[model samples]
Target: MTDERSSTSPDEQRSDPHDSSDGETADADATSDENDVNENDADGNDNADEFTIADFHDASQQEGRPVLTAAAVSRALELSHEEANERLEALADRGALERLAVSTDPVVWYPTELEDLTDRERVVVFPKQREIVVDRPDQFTRAQLSQFAHLADANGEQGYRYVVRPADIWGTPHDSFEDLARTMRQALGQRSDALEEWVHSQWDRAHQFRLTTHEEGYTVLEAQSPEIMGNVARQKLDEEHVHAPISETEDWVREGSEAAIKRILYEAGYPVQDHRELESGEELPIELEVRLRDYQQTWVDRFAEAGEGVFVGPPGSGKTVAAMGAMAHVDGETLVLVPSRDLAQQWADAILEYTSLEAHQIGQYHGGRKEVRPVTIATYQIAGMDRHRSLFDDREWGLVIFDECQHVPSDVYRRSTHLQSKHRLGLSASPIREDDRQTEIFTLVGPPIGTDWEALFEAGFVAEPELEIRYVPWGDDEQANAYGSADGREKYRIAAENRGKIDEVRYLLSAHPDAKAIVFVDYLDQGRELSEALEVPFLSGETPHHERRRLLEEFRRNERDLLLISRVGDEGIDLPTADLAIVASGLGGSRRQGTQRAGRTMRPAGGALVYVLATRGTREEDFARKQLQHLGRKGMTIREQAVERGED
Candidate 1:
């Protein structure tokens, strides 16, 4: 909300109304007060009439309150307290407002109607629960929360709930606790002594341990005090993590166990401050061919300070470009690790297109190719193998980058986290896991440096697609009977593969004939049937890499209008942006899968659409909602509609 308000009619405008001691002379008094709140003298509001019922919203916002006190209203509207209280009681009697009396306030007024809350945003803090709820928040509020809170859930319409987790406070990229507190006050619009005290204690908890490189070239883990070292660190750690105790508060960390040490300490309630000076490798000339956006530059600047971070942003938000920007900032030999050969190829192409890296200087070290140059791109599986580990041992890498970093906490994937570098970077739109090991992502890499997805949507940097979940009836009695008899996963699968959806898919594709689209199917049988019906090629795991490359290139160049893909296209392979996306099956997939498919059309040009199809009167309906819940949390609206059964 801004202090400066725009001038419009009472119904259209949100501004504080001038109160009159007496009716006809009130306009003159308002003019003299010169309240800038939503008044437009140029818009003929100069001859404004008496008070409007809607004007109370202006007073509420001006006073920075979700609920208004009579004193606050008096100060905002230039009226006496008695007049304000009388007006509030009248409005309550008219059913336009409600009043509540709390221990801290005598009485406060809130809108009886939800639409009456016309403030730019509404924020409610539950200090005891450590949660913040916001409705239709602006970019500034979202950015503030990302620093020290985790987005827990959203009501799918206008409300977002963020929970302040210990990890959030520990990994906060602030200079001091005072600065963090100031940001909290700004975001919350008020200070909570109880919440601030809890936050301060957590902030102190994060700084209780430190990891540093010693003068003799060994790593040391230090605690804030001897008691902490003995009680927390010493009791939690073992000889595998550290060689021995160097002192009461310092331990000589074992070689190659630095990551383990940090993880153990962090899990034990102390976050280790890493200050080891590592190699920046031999300098390699590099520069970004494209200009960095303001937020991308800020991310690079922050990472340059911390030496490690994950670039978390929605799909099509130019994360690869930002990674290139980070590479240019470091200007050293870089090793980029991806999840698949397709992504490795995409990374190599992006580095070439956006950076001044020579083609010959870059190499791919996967099953298809094994060349390690100054700038190498390899798959995570290969790079972590004991045999392939020797390939990277000789050449010092200044930076190690992980694409699709949500996989970093897995058993095999975590092996690659042991790789030492001066800088570490990870990229993922959704860095979540079913096992709840997401915290390991931060400990393995670094704190997250991300742009709020809403910021990008508002700035038109990414399109917020029109998302709809359409539930279709079963094609025939046979399929309906089969689903009714089955239970558990089989029942869900039968519902998801409902034959009725074929016609719905045909209808949607026919309706948007000019729009480029991708239809995602989970099983091979369903994919083949849809491919045959739509007369489109289905790309799946069985498709040859070269053919996948050819079809994706055609799609990117706009030569192909429609394509069918399997779960393989959910991630790892960068499918070209489409104008429409249809989930023909697999509504029960993971939340990441749903978002990855919806994100195919989330480009800056807008006018994107995503249709999720589920069988009506089955568990598939619930599965569809559950799958897209992550997008709901990210501020995307999900509309639901029922499909009419075709004439039997």
Candidate 2:
């Protein structure tokens, strides 16, 4: 239970009460004049003695009524009556203290020069407790009080308050403030003790049994225990109330007996939580055997040590395998998040093969799959739909693994950002986004703990694809006549499916006849046309998942030479075979997209071949150049050529 109380700042209370009235302007002028006079008086007091609590109290007794008698003043200062009386008169003359009443029976003094009564009052009330009582009932109403009660209830054991009004309940004068204080005391009956008990229970639950002294230092207890209880415990010795400092509590807890502390906590209504640590002579599940590559091992170590961070690599860098291995090491549930439906199934199937765990223990939640695993793989799309329900359902993930973390910058991604998880591991082929929202990702997720595609390729973690940029010249008639009504996408599609390029696709197919060649196109229409012209199978977003899997399996087994694929393969999809790529269409100038597309061939199965066919003298070439720049900077020579010799 957290603390919820009206802890408004003293600055807020000290604001002028007449600020809303028309006379505020005149009051401000008067305050300014008084401030100037005070400054002048201060300047003239270079030789003046410093004011003491004695002088302040003497003057306070003089205000309104006799708050203090001469005998009380002598007792407070531990001085002779004549000596105290002479000192009081001297203080009154200097304006440090003033006489309140006409009769000198027992002249009480008050600090008349102190305009800010609240600060002086706080010095009396709070002192060493680091607490302040506002005692202002005029600012709150009945409904507000009820609301405050509700807030206190929500905050549970940490809330405390007292409310009082002037009704002569304590047999004191209405203007004396004693009746008001008595009412407040009645309202707050036993609340202070209740708060102390609550804090003691929390510390006992932390399982630190020793009641040791804590010096002044901040302590961050992960949970409640006896050491913590000791910190809050108060003792009375020789008319003094002494409490342990926070530092002492920390040291005592560190050396305390765990069992004794747990017992004390259980007695105090705070039971010790069972954090399942591995025990001696207790064999773990035999099915937990995991085999990891060197890179995967590095990632797991990094995640364990860093707590929360990202892991980046291109396709086939074994992100899923590393994540699953890390999950096997955790005691609680693991939640794996992927961007797309196809990738979700791929991950689930992969997890099943890696662990000897039951099929039901490895779950799948995505567009096309059913969720049944204790260690579930959920899609970001479904998780982002209705957040309150989703967050409530999946708040217990021990390790949250995000696949394709580049998509985290999207608006929909923020839905899962605040969900509490102590351990997080994000996987991305390319962590960089079109918009520089990497910082937001770092906050929501953790810092990127992995590398990009270029790093993976250089380390031989992935394959090195032979690059070729083929500039398929637009037909001479395309240059003479413009497709005026066509959108940019439509024009690119027309150019991609040009008959000459169709023949060139056949020529590329013929050149890599035995080797499996993938024809990568932009539009579905272009995929269909190219598949028909080359007499080969193709896959697109519209294709059912089952059929798509079957077709990819056949192609991977070297059953198909020319397989046409669309932008659906842009992400981390399984394309085990078909090394050669024919970039039939794409956005110009962004090497990131091009690099991702080319990465399709980087998986070390057979050799890789990239053939980017862009229409000559169009924005497609410019886009292709921009994409090639990222590769060229990484030491990949980008060679360009023309499909058919034509005039510029």
Which tens-of-lDDT digit does each residue in 424-541 have in candidate 1? Answer: 9998888878678988998899888887776677766677888999989998899999998998899988887888989999999878877888999998888888888888899999
lDDT by residue (tens digit), candidate 2, 1-648: 111112211111212222333453355455445545544564588744434543444344334233556566677656688876776777677766667664667466666655533332221112124132322222211112221111111111222222221111111112223333322222222123333333333333334332322233221222344444454332111112222234543222332233233333434444333222211111223243445555566667766655555765655566666776666666556677777777777777776666666666777776666563457777787778773345326345666777877776688875655443236677765566667655455445654455333334544556567778777765457632554456776665566555556767777777766565677877777788787887777798888888898888776555655578887877746565345777877645244567677766665443667888877766667777776765654434467886665322
For each candidate, what TM-score against the reference?
0.83, 0.53
Q: Which clashing pairs does model 1 show?
A: none
* Top-scoring candidate (TM-score): 1
The C-alpha local distance difference test score for the whole of candidate 1 amounts to: 0.81
Task: List, in order, the clash count of every candidate structure.
Answer: 0, 32
Q: Any runs in candidate 1 off by more than 4 Å, and if so which?
A: 1-117, 153-158
Lowest-sum lDDT 10-residue window in model 1: 1-10
TM-score of 2: 0.53
Which structure among the candidates has the greatest lDDT? Answer: 1
